[model samples]
Target: MKAVAGRMKRWRNSLRLRLLAGTLVWIVVAVLAAGWGLSSLFNKHVSRQFDAELGTHLDQLAANLVFDEAQTLRLRAPLSDPRLARPLSGLYWQVDRMGAAGEPETVALLRSRSLWDAVLAVPPDALADGEMHVHHVRGPNDEPLRMIEQVLRPAEYPDQALRLIVAATEDLISEPVARFNDLLGFALGALSLGLIGAVVVQVRTAWMPLERLREGLAQVHDGRNAAIEGRFPSEIQPLVDEFNGVLARNAEIVVRARTQAGNLAHAIKTPLAVLANAANRDDSALARVVVEQVALAQLQVDHHLARARAAAAVQIPGQRTAIRPVMEALVRVMERVHVERGVQITVGDFPETTAFRGETQDLQEMLGNLLDNAYKWASSRVDVKVAARNGDLVVTVEDDGRGLDASVREIVLERGVRTDEQRPGSGLGLAIVRDLALLYGGDIALDASPRGGLRASLRLPRA
Candidate 1:
């Protein structure tokens, strides 16, 4: 469930997905609109043709009409359509005589044989002679129909006018329209699928350049390249150029800061050396005071300068330092420095691939302090282990010597705080390690070791 939620969040945040979703919505709406419009047009066209067929039949029936000597109207020749000749065949025609003055009834004179004994009953209306009218009406079988009617006076009997109607079932038009709509729906469905496929291809093609840009940035982050590289589409090339420019500016700033820190260190160390030499040549209390203050000033300068260098190094991108070599080198040096004590420095399970994400100098400085403290307090064994966990590198230094009390573990991390006053050296090792770790977004912790000694665990960014 968490994985599904993570994927959903990523999709919601993706530009390509949002663009594709919006495009598909518009495509659906457009397809529906077009389908509706085309179906309407087709229905209108089919209806017109159906009505024209009825109109032709009406015209034929009117032309074939004849009046007998008694003035009774009849068809001289039957309609050519076979459906009109069959009883209840859904096609029919009828004739009606105009009623005399003050008469409200119309007299039915003749009708097509298809009507059997029934008639096509049209609604009564004041229709002009020679004019055609159309309506939806009920036929012989009470079935729905499209009826066309006309009123006319025959040339043989100019004063006697007759009403004529021809009708066919409404199914003739409805069935065709329904079938057309079904076929249209199928065709449009296929077209929609094709369009959706085209949209998917288009979106992927358009986003390819961004994918390449992401890969290039990853290369830079992994210390494989100093800046983004490779050709890009014209639209995305400008962004690539701007990003490289920012990286260049950042590199320049880091170089300038490093150079300034170096110059400051050189400038201050010379003045401090002269003061120390001048104090040693004199024996007065004033010279001794100057000597001690100069020493303290030198220490302060060194401490802040180390911090400045670490701060600057953290800002430089793509820095990776292998932990194994640094730990091995520190162990060799510390073993030789404490040769008389016979301290057996042993490295624990430290993978060669485990690396710090900062400068080599900073990693060395932080680990050097921790290992040195462990070596100083160790009886016969010192152990150092380096491992990576949760985007951070952890280095554990353990010594088999008397460990500090639990209450003073936190206090020792303070500046100038020593666990034993008898121990020879300034009490700034752990404090310097803490300051440097914090500068690089890392931390150092002190704990009692399982080996009955101190354990200094340093956590820093991993590459």
Candidate 2:
């Protein structure tokens, strides 16, 4: 049931299916209506022609009909149609004499050879003199017949009245009508198929621009292009223009935020340096406290500035940087900075094509913090590895120093929390790394390393 519902949901969500379904329904309805209307009209026309032929024969029989002096009815001249003389031919004529003015019963006075000892069992009805009436009745062999009859009073024998009838099998009318309906059905079926094909082509042609637009957007989103590019139809051009405009504005906003953060950092660092120098001139307790507070203020400023820069930069699209080169460069910088500690930084083999889907600067900031901590804490060596996994770039850095206890691992990731005060650095390295990773829709995790020190693993979106 869930699978059926899912299929139904997908069909409802498709524009092509909706268009095709609606067009096909209308085509079926129109074809059916046309077939019915054409068939009905053809049947009516053939029926009228059939009735006219019978009526003409009836008129000929009436004009030639007369009674001799013996009061016997006879036709002065025979009908022109040859079927009237052939036995059970399907066309026949008869003459009958009425017993009384209002009597329904009639005696057959004469009939064509086509009757072949059989009679047309026409229903009794009030037939006015010289006026023809039509009916459907049984003829020879119980075959259905369409009949026309007229009652007439002869001038030579005014007291004697006669009825004349001409009939033919109903197949004359039915056969042609059946043939026409079959042909009409076949023609309409072909037309319906042609129309459906036309609808399919029109739908696909009309949606081609949308398909192209989707591909273009995917390129932009996957960081292969900075903006969508293509000439679209007028109907979709406005949407493309609006989307490109939004991307441009986003990049501008990111740049503006980074510039503001940099300006604020520069404005605050000078005063902090002066305060630190003044406090260093005295060895009193108050001087030491002042120096410690100034240093803490500087770290807070740096932390917030990094957070602001990363948060703003992450909002822009189409940024990608190779992982191997960035990690290699950061490792060299870390080795040089911690040269006195003799910490050996080793990078593992990694694919050069492995890339992070974010700004190069942001990637450097996050990796720099992680590697700096590992280098500072390592006893002898630090190991860094980069790999692409599950559409993400995973970077792991481990050190050979004493690893943190499980209880303090999570604590050290918090802002300004130091595991050991003797370590010559602010305790915001892992916290800053955590904040930067989260800004890029990524994260950093710390665990016990096989090298015996803390292992920091960073996961970011792969380009």
Candidate 3:
């Protein structure tokens, strides 16, 4: 059931499927309507032709009708149609004397040989002199027939009235109509197939630009290109232009924000440095307190500035930084900074293509903090491992010193929370890393490392 619903959702979201389905429905309806209309028209035409032929036969029989000297009715000349003389040929003509009640009396009937051993039973209807009426009736052998009849009266014998009827089996109309319908069905079926093929071609051609646009966006998203690139039809060109404008605006905003953050940092730190210098010259208790507070203010400024920079950078597009190069550079720097401790940092094997889908500086800041914290806690060695899992880049920094308690693991990630005051740090390292990871839609966690020290694991988007 879930699989069926998934397919339904996918189909609903697909433009190609919607277009094809809509076009197919219209095609089927049009083809069926055309077939019905054409068949109806052909049936009507054959019926009119069949009735006209019967009318002509009736006129011939009427003109040849006469009376003998004994006042008995007969045909002076036989009908020109050969079917009239052929027994049970499905074509026949008859003449009947009307009784006083205006009904035809079969006792005084004269009929063609085609009516051999049977009679045409045309239903009673009021007919005017020389005016014909048509009917569907049964003839010899119970064959369905189309019939036409006329009433006539001689001038010499005005009292005597007669009815003349001409009929043929309904096959005259149905047979030709059936053959026409067969031909029409084949022709219409072929036409429907051709129309459907043309519709498919049209849909593919129309949607080609959209497919190309999607690919262009993918390339931009993957950071291979800064913006969508392709020649598009006029219909889609405006959308492409607008999207590229958005990307340009986003980059400008990030650059402007970083510049302002840097300027604000400089503006605030200069005043704080001046205060510290002034307070250091005096050895009073008030001066010492002022120095301590100035140092705290400086730390807060730096942390906020870093956060502001990362927040702006996170919004910029096409930002992919390779993990190995950044990790290697940070490791070198950390080794130089902690050279006296004799702590060695070893990076695990990782593919050169492994990368973070974020800015280079942000990755540097996050990894630098992790590595520095690991090096400080390690007795002799620090280990760095990187892996890609479930569309995330997971980096683990472990130290081989005493590990932190489970209670303090989450506590240390909070801002300004230091486990050891002698560590000589603001205690914002893990906190800053956590904030930066969160800005990039990732997370950081602390665990007991297999190396018997703290394990700082970071999960970030993999590019």
lDDT of 1 by residue, 1-463 (tens): 9999999999999999999999999999999999999999988998899889988998998889987788667788988999988989998888888775412245578888899999777887778888888899987677999998888888888777688888899999889989999999999999999999999999999989999999999877766678999999999999999999999998899889988998998899999999999999999999999998898788778888888888888767778888888888987888888788888887878667888878888888888888788878999998888778887888888999999899999999998888788976678889999999998888998888999998999999888
Task: Give the candidates in order of lDDT, highest first.
Answer: 3, 2, 1
Q: Give candidate 3 regions above 4 Å deviation.
A: 10-20, 270-295, 328-351, 370-414, 417-427, 443-459
Q: 215-280 in candidate 2: lDDT tens per residue? A: 898788778887889899998999999999999998998899889889999899999999899999
On a 0 to 100 scale, what is the lDDT of residue 127 in model 1? 80
lDDT, candidate 3, at 185: 97
TM-score comparison, 1 vs 2, better candidate: 1
- Tell me which of candidates 1 and 2 scores higher on lDDT: 2
Spell out the clash pairs found in candidate 2.
none
TM-score of 1: 0.77
In model 2, where do residues sit more than 4 Å from their true spots?
1-7, 98-107, 139-142, 158-161, 277-296, 324-354, 364-462
Error of 3 at 365 (Å): 2.1
The CA lDDT at 101 in model 1 is 46
- The model with the greater TM-score, 1 or 3, is 3
Candidate 3 residue lDDT tens string, 1-463: 9999999999999989998999999999999999999999999999999988998999899898888898878889899999998999999998988888889896647999888867778788877777889898987788888999999997758898889999999998999999999999999999999999999999999989999999998878767788999789998999999999999998898899899999999999999999999999999999999999999999999889989988987777778999988988898899899999999888889999999988898899899999989888899999889999998999999999999999889999999999999987889999999999999899999989998898989999888
Model 1 lDDT at residue 459: 92
What overall lDDT, based on C-alpha atoms, would model 3 receive against the true structure?
Answer: 0.91
